[model samples]
Target: MAERDGGLLLFLTGAGISAESGIPTFRGPEGYWRVGSVNYRPQELATFQAFSRMPDVVWGWYLYRRGVCRHASPNAAHLAIVRAEERLGDRFHLVTQNVDGLHLRAGSSLARTYAIHGMIDFFRCARECTAETYPIPDALPLDWAKDRLPTPEERARLRCPRCGADGRPHVLFFDEYYDEPRFHCESAQRKALEASALVVVGTTGLTNLPMRIGAIAAQRRIPVHVVDLEPNPFVEFAEVTGGEFLRGPAGSLVPELVERLVG
Candidate 1:
């Protein structure tokens, strides 16, 4: 079928897309927190409450993740999304659940791509003293082993410049709520409502905002195609929305899908 005439085509991505780029899926067994007997699950460590209780530990964990993101290159799936954006221009929008910044690294424009989960490379004031979220300096160590907590000096470096408060990763923690200015939940929904079609890649429909997007598309009669490695709720979601389900890794499927759409 030809691409939809005028409305936007939204591409929503999740952790599974980044996993193809050698980044470990944070929800998998590898994501277990094992820092010196303080065994926390991925969900536990990814909360604001956890960060409030142990900022050093939280910083260390994110530092390791940042290192992993830094070392990894954008995969074919990411590059394909960028190419689609180039072809579609204003008709293309990317709403990603990943914080790895892979989409941006792959040349997706920041103006058009909404990182609803926040980014690993940026830090915001814990006190919210300023609306600014600053990029972590490259001079800082990204490869710090997770076995030890960040040193006092290293922790000090993470402090907010505008205030004496600690700098927290600019990510939406499990305990946090999504807002328009920060995580762009409202904007994503708006885009979903306006979209003629949606392409969901590498997500399992586990998160609220993503599910909301799918529901909006389904309710509006917009086609919702899904790309995943295994059968998940999204496959059923696709069926319900009168869309196709392509069962395979996004790295292979997304590029081919983009070619078909744009050609």
Candidate 2:
């Protein structure tokens, strides 16, 4: 699967890919971070209502995730994708489920990269209210410790600067709908549909309307490969499962894939 290049290599990734960096998957080691059970479901922490009604809780979750992502370095798998992108050039699209800007931070210049989950580094005007909101690219509050404790000021201003509604993490909640242009962003997917090769990594394959996109590639008989820890529903759309669907983590498997493509 890695050997094929010079065509579209759409790399779709998920939270599992980031787990190698010691960052917790929404359901971390003990499972959920909430009380009672360690297995925590994102629920309120990642919802439109939570973002709108409970900005503090939602943003607090973002704060915790932000801190983790800020300090977390991209793993070998991420770098491998970058290398593969360099090898494939414009032929590759690294679409990710994660909102964290890790791939961008990893020096991935591949412009086709898409963030289905939105971004944490940049905040928007809550409800698309204004054209501009404060873009905090590099850092966070000066006093993260106090901020974590839910200081009063932090709670008040967390409101969205865009709509004057409450501000929440820029991440896409399950109920939220993407404006199409920003989420899918461009004609990249259409181009990839016409691609000679397609690649999916680490995703659970439960995202948006894939039936149409999947059919596009199937109609063309484009070679598709799936890589993950377990069998993904998208695997059926693939011609082959080149890497373990549920075995090696992305950090371990991605480099091998890069080397294959680059070879």
Candidate 3:
């Protein structure tokens, strides 16, 4: 059926897409980094508690990640998704787990894109004095060294404008739950319900919201397609839900699939 038939096509992306752009996946070896003299995993470091106890360490980790993202350019997969968005207009929607902001950089409209994981280059007040999100301070270096602590001047810059409280990275930490204001949890669920098909790329279905979107689509019995290099839960979502798992690298397969779907 043609997309003009009022069917919405939803595309969900993950770290795998950004991995093609040279950014490291969260579960990879790079996810393990040092905080001062101690080693910490992404799961351990990416939590409210960690940030509360040692905001400098957490900020250092994200700044290093931002540096990695800044060095990498959008890959074929990102551009392909942009092309799909251009062609489909409002009929297409993207829900990305990647915080690298590559999708926006590749020209995907922000209005049509949902970044449930949060943006890497933005921050908000940790004290919740205001809901306003702000861009990373220009004074702070984009790429911070591993295990480095913020200097006195850098720490001052990281303070919230509203309350002079410490500013937290806008990212959804491991311990945090999803919500409408930051993560667009409810809207994503509603969009999944409206979608005629769900295309999952490069994710293993480990996160809560993406998995929930997949489950919602599965319950609706709509077409669910998964593209990845190996078998994962998303592949199973496709197969069990009467869809197909297109096994291949996203840089090659995603463009081909988008072309076939929208051509």
Candidate 4:
């Protein structure tokens, strides 16, 4: 199957990559990006000003996200991607659109990984009064279904540890500039693509960025391989699967990919 692809190996993945660990991949209608359900607009919630003025609303969502991702341990499929890269070394690049940070926790390196939405790892002041995005205690997401955006007095209380200014989660929201494009994400993506192979996994191929990566691979003529449990509207280029890659809720298919590559 890889023979159809020229050579470079890159994995442009989305929520499906993390889905095996019980993480929800953003999908249509009920997906994370959908509107009209009290779901705050992506860009509005992710922005510094928004968080500064509505910390509870914004942080509440993030805290909820953290709760899910906190327990989203890496599975065999995730580790397989890691192991495949270890064998392939510089030849492989895993470019994921996920913010769960599971790739890193699975032991993919900072140099080896690329996240376009930014990770939920750090918090920065809304004013950005300081240069640092500080780390803080990971808190549980508060129930804000009944609560509206915080009032002015409420805003004053949620301050960043680095500069004492308001802060927000680091994930990229709708209408917001992608963290990678805003912060050298593309450059690293270019580097990842340059002379390397690509493997697209668990992506819907319906998204802008992940789909764009597919286009980029086609344009650059990089070798691309995709694996998924079901057919994806997002991809027509790679192999397809009808079975869940991750085993009966505990094991994973990524290890199978590793076996395929190794033996």
TM-scores for all candidates? 0.95, 0.79, 0.94, 0.72
lDDT of 3 by residue, 1-263 (tens): 32656689999999878878888886666877785578888888899999988888888888888877877899998999898888888889999999998999999998999889899988999998876789887788866776677787887887899899988899999899888888888998999999988999998888889999999988888889898888888776787778889988899999998888887
Show how many residue pairs clash in every candidate, following the order shown: 0, 15, 0, 16
lDDT of 2 by residue, 194-229 (tens): 576665666675766333445556667776666777
What TM-score, to 2 decimals, does candidate 3 have? Answer: 0.94
lDDT of 1 by residue, 1-263 (tens): 32647668899999889989999977767677677766777888899999999987788788888988989999999999999999889999999999999999999999999999899999989998976888997767877666557788877888899987989999999899988877888999999988888999998888899999998888888778899888777676688778989988888999999898775
lDDT against true structure, model 4: 0.60
Q: Give candidate 1 misplaced runs (Cα > 4 Å).
A: 1-4
**Candidate 1, clashing residue pairs?**
none
TM-score of model 2 relative to the true fold? 0.79
Candidate 4 residues 34-73, lDDT tens each?
2236665454555666655656777655655665676679
**Where in model 3 is the C-alpha error above 4 Å?**
1-4
| Alpha-carbon runs more than 4 Å astray in model 4 | 1-8, 26-53, 129-132, 138-158, 179-183, 239-252
Please, what is the whole-model Cα lDDT of each candidate in the order they appear?
Answer: 0.87, 0.63, 0.86, 0.60
Q: Number of the top candidate by lDDT? A: 1
- 176 in model 1: Cα distance from truth in Å? 1.3
Q: Which ten residues in a row have the lowest lDDT in candidate 4?
A: 241-250
